[model samples]
Target: MFEAIKLLVGVVSLIMVYRTITGNCNKYLAFAICAIWLRYFLSAFHTITYPSLVAGFSINALGSIGVAGLGLLLIPTAVFTLKKLFPFYVFFTAIAVSGFVNMQIPGTINVLVKWCYFLVLAGALFLSIRCQGQNETFKKLLVAFVMPVSLQMLSIVLGEAKATEADGSTSYIGGYNHEAAFSMIIVSFIFVLGLVNRNAISFRTTLFTVAVVLLVLVNYRTAILTILPIAAIFYFTLVEQRLKPSQKAPVLTIVTMVLAILFFVLSLSMQERFADVGLLVGNLDLIFKAPMYFSDAEQDIMSARVYIWSQYINAFTNADLLHQIFGFGPDSWKHKFDLYAHNTYVSYVYEYGYLGFISFIGLMAYILTASFNLSNKPLGKILAFSLIGFMIMNMATMPLWNIEGLIFFALALGTVFANPSAQKVSKEIGAGHKTSMEIN
Candidate 1:
């Protein structure tokens, strides 16, 4: 019975997402529905009822694939890039070739599956860039999408939920984990939204303040640390300059900064009591104490990420040209040992080698640089900050592989890149560039 309900909810969510992208209903309404569905499905349905059979085809996985496919289909309709589809084609082609090579090498099928998912993620991002261009009202709709998620996160923090892993170990849902990524995305989204709508100073300030508080409660250190600083930079560089020289803007900025600093300090103070942070620290200490407790002290450091990263770095020190070019293949690292590098940069270099890693980095750099260059308008500034937040989160966490993160990134990107007018529009009603005709 629970399985059936879960499936039904998943299907409904997908339909709503479709309607939203196609602009059938108010995008904000559709986004609100989707956010509610996701929160309930993850928190209520997935947790309360364990339906193994139905769970085999989980909503999260299916949604990831579906969004990617849909994005591919819409590429041709985008007006921003003449051959807009080519970037996606090249990106996925690399994943496919590398994935196949990994499969042929001695390793588990898990590697292939992971890369395939990443390829789909690339597709989702491509579509988002397309969508961002065409969807002028995305800023308003995005606020609706983020509100419920923020409220749900607040509930978890206040409710004192236990943080445990499948192996009965303490685990903080840190960077790249589903919860952390979701929180980061929403907070970043809100910040950007606030900046874009800065003309309504009270509304924007209220929203930004709320977002910062929620960000602290989420207790994802990387998300909080990375986003807050970058957001401040973005605001000063882009949003602050637009405001008139008055007592209001400076006063508000000072208040915002003080509150942000206070929140950061309070969150750190509370970390000792938080279950996830305690567990994570405990585990790290245990993993580092192998020398005195056991004879096989060498393997003790395997579980320590710092140790593993050092090892990976050293492993590549004497690697040959061919190995550097083609890489060790997907999941090959796991086959050699039962550990992961836990860092994206190291993981990419180890799996795909130097050439592949450089190519991937270059692609990301191009996307980021291009996006930053285009962020001349109010909406564009929001998109730029959001992209920066996303990039920062990815550096520490692996949400680039997750469905939710991928889709959100895609939506933001598509909306920005697909619309030429997005670049030309001014934040001020009658400043800079204007025509007699306006959307009103």
Candidate 2:
């Protein structure tokens, strides 16, 4: 049954890609992104049916090749402006230099090419919005995202695959490699849907939010810590326009305090590594101290993330000047450590070096600043809150390390930096508000 479902998804995704390429669908980039994601489901199904093929999967890997191909074909259709993409350009350059310096040319090239594909995806989105307008393009995007996500949600409920945690709790990971990754997809979908439904709250939106919250709470308890606050903020933002200025501040403050308390209590209920949240809090002093100073017991806190972080930090500090500047290489942790750096900050510094690290941080800073500047815009608020939740998730796990997370990142970046002109957005929104108010 799962095999049949996976095959159906693959066929549908391929058809979408073909339609996109032939100009039958203006959602060319959306379908292209869909193809990349659907490929994972197909690959997972293949692996399940034939475990022997697992070895070959890694060897034959061409990361996001599906999107890259479509993106390349669409290049002429879209103007490849770099003004909004300047930070990405710098980060890419730094990583490429680091790859060459560390003699990890093959690995670096693979990583660089993968991101370049996303750049093309961003450009395609830019062109789509420019040519078709934001509302129409976003409606298409909702369809594209919903088509694949429906299958993923189905897998979560009915698929045989499950993730067993250290404490013997089993998480329904659906088609994803990890529960957290699967939940990231859910969160991304929710935020985008919120953007689409920005005109008003509806039964569908409310129900979807409730379902997503339940899914995250059961499958990935830690994510709820972030998602709860985000969802609360989103609810407040949507309703704030209805409230008088005098009511807004007190309502927000009271809700925030209540949610904070609830979040604290919920954190203590997490299983396995996440249950160590209190232990992590108690060891704040030890965490900031030098890695070498950490005792064995203290190192074991937070699923040994402290120890893993220390190892990466110390390794970087002890490296020669060139290595320190450029870092070991993309994914150097595979060779350098027994465990992956659970922290994105530590991992980037170790793999990309300070140059790449600083560039990446600058990229994030740009997104945050841009989001803040456009906060009054509905899409802007969604991007800001979603980005905040994503970044907070990264403190413990490397969301950027996987395709699902990168897909969200690409979507967020593409939407934010793709178009600088808000005139279209304003006109559409003004028109929408007039119509809505008339009906009301």
Candidate 3:
């Protein structure tokens, strides 16, 4: 049954990609993104017949290389002269240079596969901007995100999602690897959808938000920390309008207070709800203990991640000048060190070195700068902030590598930085366009 579902989703995805390429109708990117996401959400139904996102299930596992149909179109259509795209090429150059400098050159297949995955993101991003020009496609993509996200939330109720014993502890992996992280990201995207559509107060949006809230509880994680940040964004945008400019400077203090109250109420409520289901992990006691994290060197030392991160940092710090500049190839450290840094930023620095890091960060800096500057408008702000939340999540986890998620990010980036839309966003932001836009 699961295999059939997976196969069906795969077929639909391919068809969408084909239409997107042949038709020169870029809006189909939305369909492809969701179709791929459906596969991720369906992983909640993992059984022996169809194991979780292992080989044979994902596109690559199904004996295909990285995305082919879209790649052909994107390769021809993508331009990198734009300041927003310069960083990716620089990062690519850094990665290529690393192979020659590092003693343990990254394996051919390993390097190629990694490059293909990133190329897919670049392709999707290029089209995403084009999608905005096709307003219907851009709107459709926004709407398409909601279905998979809501269904993914529904999966919590439908499936018996429990974590397996890996690393050491018995964690609650709602479905795929870091179900908690996945939930956090999905929920953020849900909010992005609402804001993008400017229909956050609607019943449809309410239903999805409730499901997301339920799913967040199911995961029993601090990944929902973004809620504090999000709630603050909402408050300042909606509430602080009546305040004087002097009061606006202290908005952070108000935001901090709001977060404190929210954390208390939310933690208590989540604890009680989860406890009723026999699913609560740590309750507020664990949360209140967060301060201990700052002082708890012993606990940090005991953490497997700390050990992994240390090993990675030491390798770069101790390497020769060339290795330090270029770093090991992506995942190359894991082959030699027996462990990989679980942190994405740390992992990137280890895999590509300072040069790669600078190029990548420089590129994102441009994108993010634009995102920040455009936060005055509705869709522009929504997509920009959504990207911000995604980046924050990547600080601790590597969900960005997930193609479904990566494609979504690229699409959003394009909407923010791509051609006519990018210019439009700047003008709109400068003019302080209305806070909400009707979904046309």
> What would the per-residue lDDT of candidate 1 be over residues 329-367, giving only the tens digit for each residue?
765676665656756677777777776677677766666
**Candidate that beats the other on lDDT, 1 or 3, i.e. the better one:** 3
Which scores higher on TM-score, 2 or 3? 2
TM-score of 2: 0.80
Error of 2 at 419 (Å): 4.9
Q: Give a tens-digit lDDT track for model 2, residues 280-320.
A: 77766655567778888777776677777878888888889
For model 2 the local lDDT of residue 214 reads 48
- The RMSD of every model to the true structure, in order and in angstroms, is 7.6, 5.8, 8.0
Q: What is the lDDT of residue 176 in candidate 2?
A: 44
Candidate 3's C-alpha runs over 4 A off are 1-31, 34-69, 74-83, 103-135, 142-155, 164-181, 184-188, 200-204, 218-222, 226-260, 267-303, 419-440
lDDT of predicted model 1? 0.49
Per-residue accuracy of model 3 over 1-440 as CA lDDT, tens digit each: 43354355445644544544455445435434544444454443345324425533543433224343355455544343445556666766777777656644434345545445545545554455454442534434443344334444444555635553332323333344455445544654555444433343346445545644654644534345434444445544554555687887687577667767876787786563223222213232321233324344422432334445556676677778867777877558657776556566777788778888888778777777776666446455555666676676665456555554455465556566543345555666789994323211
The better candidate by lDDT, 2 or 3, is: 2
Model 2 misplaced regions, further than 4 Å = 4-33, 36-40, 43-60, 77-79, 145-161, 198-202, 214-218, 244-265, 268-273, 285-296, 419-440
